[model samples]
Target chain A: MTRGRGFFPIIRSWSIAAVAALAVLAGPAAVPALAKDYSHIVIATEGAYPPYNMHAPDGKLIGFEIDLGNNLCARMHITCTWIAQDWDSMIPALNAGKFDAIMDGMSVTPQRLKVIDFSIPYTQSPTTFLVLKSSPLAKMPDTGKRVSLDDDAAMKAAIAAITPALKGKTVGVQVATIQYNLLHTYLRNVVTIRTYKTTEEHDLDLASDRIDAAIASTSYFVSTLNKPGGNQFVEVGPLFTGGLLGKGTGVGIRKSDPELVAMFNQAIEAAKKDGTIRALSLKWFKTDISPPN
Target chain B: MNTSNPFVLLGFGPNGWGASLVAGAAMTLAVSIAAYLVGLVFGGLAAWARIAGPRPARRLVGLYTTVFRGIPELLVIYLVYFGGSEALTSLGHLFGRSGFIGLDGFLAGTLAVGLIAGAYQTEALRGGFLAIPRGEIEAARAVGMGRLLMLRRVIAPRALRFALPGMGNVWQQVLKESALISVTGLSELMRAVNVASDSTRLPFDFGIAGFALYLVLTSFSGGVFRNAERSLARHERAR
Candidate 1:
């Protein structure tokens, strides 16, 4: 054992060096040739978001956006592969060319447009507050009513109506999201706002009464309510859309990929016309969220 | 069996995540092994430089170890994952390539963890070298052994024996640090478990599964290092 030990170290070190060198050479070596080839593309998604994009128990990605993405890709004549990505870094990764586009329920906001581009809106869902059924806040004002932030008077009135009930209450929303923006901009003075990393975390907090209420898209809440302990939660308050919420969920693409964005827009238009979007939305969300023509 | 049962859910059924979880564990091991090997190369070279190289070489290694060890592992990972691609893309532009050239997730993660692990490994290897008795080196020289011959016959063996335990500790560190690679979206064990839990809405079940798998890996690797240490020390015991 002792006789061979010294040689082993020398050989091991050499092999280690060799492996490191090979890894360095192989790691970023696959430079996607700068061609206008639209034959094959990779799409990224935050697979944790249900009814939009989510992983199945079998490790396959499936959901509303998955269906729509495949449909759009089919129409665009591109073979698209979907990869799960963390929500926070989705845009950066797209711009970095980690993937060609993002279809992870990403809303097209004016703030986001400054960085990346989006395809035409594929699905539009309203934002609302979720509360425990037993909580007094469950009976929030203007329940089931839609409030477009574009109508400043209606938006302010909706905020005013809910402020009195939410005063001194702690509300939860996912961080760095349109819902968080809405809360920070409008309800910052009224309620103590808490931010969470994911919608599921806030839903858990609401179920445990750590938060008086949680806010997220109505489509997301549909998945929440379908969960085992979700029966205890109820959606209240006016539905919010437009303005700060952006122009609904769309495929997030890099600004350099104008042709890809155009392709997606064309496919989406076809999908809407053919009722493919409506069918997928009904299958996943049980509602037609296809943007009105 | 009920699909809601934890065993069934983690089983190999059509709806179960057992296969994916196992695949993720394999990925975790692959990444850790690759990164550990990278650390070994960096650590060995740095140790050699710090001990015998010129003053400028030692200072450069010093700065590298300090900066890598000083930053948070997550930040290091982010820098490698995003920054690596950014650098590559710019480099491509320099070569008249217009589009992005991404650093593979597995590669970025391994380099990040390996670079961090290298800092700790450098100290361990350096200590191993320092702990070598001066007389042993002198004895090798008196025997008319050349530099490379002495290094292979005496220095390498003695230093490695001294460094075995520290190297073992660094292996453990590298294994745990591999979990952070999940952020790069390389489907490692943690990411698999997260996807499973989130998808099924059964965090408790999947969380326990992840906990068990990680425990098994750590304990099994711990045993391997212990055995390696024991084998390496056999001559001392015989004497």
Candidate 2:
């Protein structure tokens, strides 16, 4: 009889603990932390990459990716939460289960796809170089034209044009990025290569005279040049696309999260149809970088 | 939301990070041990320089300890991460080598944490050294004991006994400080939890789990060090 009486309280406490655990497992969607679910899911962004993502001086994340992510989330009935993660461990952190998905203008490259999955392309842009305006590469012909990597003649011409100026000079690129891979493959022996963890870091190093040139996305260069400190650098060399640059940037998700992928796909489609992607692209990049059809 | 799936994220399954977390904990221990040893060596040199060397040498050692101990730990980790590789490459360049000099994350993290730990350890060891009775050393000398013999028999044993508690504190400090190495991209326990949280989008879940793991590490180590102190003090009478 005493044992039976004691058992009730134990069972009651156990059930209470179990309920609390279940509530957390249900995620913010079941019981929205701040507002009604409205089928709205919160998306996370780094807010460090310019044009793709960046921070306003007032400490707000404002960039092309943030705009695109918000629009996509609105279409999918989800909210957005932009946060920063150190770029090197972003994949490891993604696999560890931090946020629902990453929409930091991460390119949909085959190499990156090995560890995680990506949504369909959202924005497409080619890689380019930004160097000191007085640098010889700035004198190269057709400075503003886009050139594909597959065009042998154009590729040779581009290589020939930049090689002499780049010879014995130091070039900076973000580590593990397509731009770094491109530099290493095409010009490793000819020039000194320095890889930084982020575009901003390389940008800082460039300003400090640590590197003669920096290679990144054209949109990124445009945004950087708009900033106060970036007035010294000018775009140089052919805009590199296809092969190694992979396709356009896309949303990244863990392989196990198929449901989340479906939800994001729906939202991305609605965003593209409504011209939200294009609008954000123009706002941040000053040009249309919406996924090329 | 099912309690039945409590083990889903923690279990050693393909989806779970249990294995990674365990490996990360092991890495943390490894880095801490390396850092503690490095601190021991650095502290010994520092104490020697301070107590036995010229006035200028002592001042320089004092400055090292002061600067390291005064600065915040996070800032120290950042300075080391960003600046360590550059410093190493410059050294390599002096040897006429070209190209980037790779300082693996683990080694760099260990060195940074160790260098910081050494500053605190130096003062502890010095206090221990100073506490040695002057009479005991004089007696050892009267008995025709050489400087080496006096240090081995009288100075070291007594100094170490007094220093045991202090050394234990330094060890604990080193263990805790290892967490800062995560920013260098070392996949230690904290970093593993970060990765898991980012991937799962369950910040609260992973953060709480990481907090629990750290508590366990500290508590377990606290017990071991307490036992060691007790054993070391067994021969001495209460003051």
Q: Residue A59: error of model 2 in Å?
A: 4.1
For residue B183, model 1's alpha carbon misses the true position, in angstroms, by 1.7
Candidate that would win on TM-score = 1
Q: Candidate 2 residues B1-239, lDDT tens each? A: 21224377776765666777777788788778877887888898999899899999999998999999999988877666556545644654575543223233455566678788889889989999999888988898999999898889888888988887899899889888999887765668887776665434454687777888888888888888889778768867564
Interface RMSD of each: 7.8, 22.5
lDDT of 1 by residue, A153-270 (tens): 9999999999999999999998789999999999999999998867777877787799999999999999888877778989999999999999898999889889988999999999
In terms of lDDT, the poorest run of 10 residues in model 1 chain B is B95-104
Off by over 4 Å in 1: A1-22, A25-29, B1-3
Name the runs in model 2 displaced over 4 angstroms. Answer: A1-44, A57-59, B1-239
lDDT digits (tens) for residues B1-239 of candidate 1: 22678778999888889998998898888888888988898888998899999999999999989999999999999999999879877866786767776655777888899999889999999999999999999999999999999999899989999998999999999999999999878889999998887666677899999999999999999999999889879976886
Which candidate ranks first by lDDT, i.e. highest?
Answer: 1
